[model samples]
Target: MNDHDLLETYEPVLRFAKSERFFPMAVEHYLERCSILPSGPLGAAGLLFHLNEPLATFIGKLEGGQYFLRFINEPLYDADA
Candidate 1:
């Protein structure tokens, strides 16, 4: 699947892209690491442990990135650098 589709499918894991804030950590790092995850429900269960943030925040973090929040301006999309 494309990056957007892959990411959308694994929304749960992506949400924990910043678990440092006690953000929902994954049941297992293998299925949660942003650099990994197989995609779909398996990926969701991985990080669907303690996270409790709104899904919109996750989308905003992915689409808007630094534009919406500076500290969490993570790169959710492919980039040249």
Candidate 2:
């Protein structure tokens, strides 16, 4: 089979609970709402890239450092309540 068919055959299905409100979003949309932060010791230094910044700018900031995307900056409703 071709690469596309192989990938499709192995793709796993995602099952979400009825109460689950969050869902996957497009990378571009997610990037627009998220900021880049250093994942390790550098995290204390604060944010590396602000929300809505260009992808190139985000990539430019990643050099010899560990980073992660912070999608939600605020706390959500209490789930246990």
Candidate 3:
């Protein structure tokens, strides 16, 4: 999936989070961090790798709490990093 597709897929969830007045903050925070990285332009795969952990953490926090967010999930795919 390309960046556009990735965003499209997550846009609804993001919108939902915004509707609930959450997640958007976390998403913005993650974007801030990602922007600093010199990863150049990346698409869906790039985002999945770079953000899987952070996004999962954010989601977990929203769902249950920091404690509930598992850091032991399968590794994400990072392209030629």
- TM-scores for candidates 1 onward, in order: 0.19, 0.52, 0.16
Tell me, by lDDT, which candidate is best: 2
lDDT of 2 by residue, 1-81 (tens): 999999999997889999997897787787777666676766535344345557545555555566766678774547845
Best by TM-score: 2
Clashing pairs in 3: none
Instruction: List where candidate 3 sits over 4 angstroms from the true fold.
Output: 12-81
Q: Which of the two, 1 or 3, has more TM-score? A: 1
For model 3, residues 1-81, the per-residue Cα lDDT tens digits are 999999888886423643573344465555434422222343322444445465534333332121212122343446735
Q: Which ten residues in a row have the lowest lDDT in candidate 1?
A: 63-72
lDDT of 2 at 52: 54
lDDT of 1 by residue, 1-81 (tens): 999999898876434444465454343442333332224554445435425644333432332122221223365455745
Error of 3 at 59 (Å): 31
Query: How would the candidate models be sorted by TM-score, starting from the highest?
Result: 2, 1, 3
Candidate 2 regions exceeding 4 Å error are 38-68, 73-81
- Separately for all candidates shown, the number of backbone clashes (residues 3 or more apart, or on different chains) is 1, 0, 0
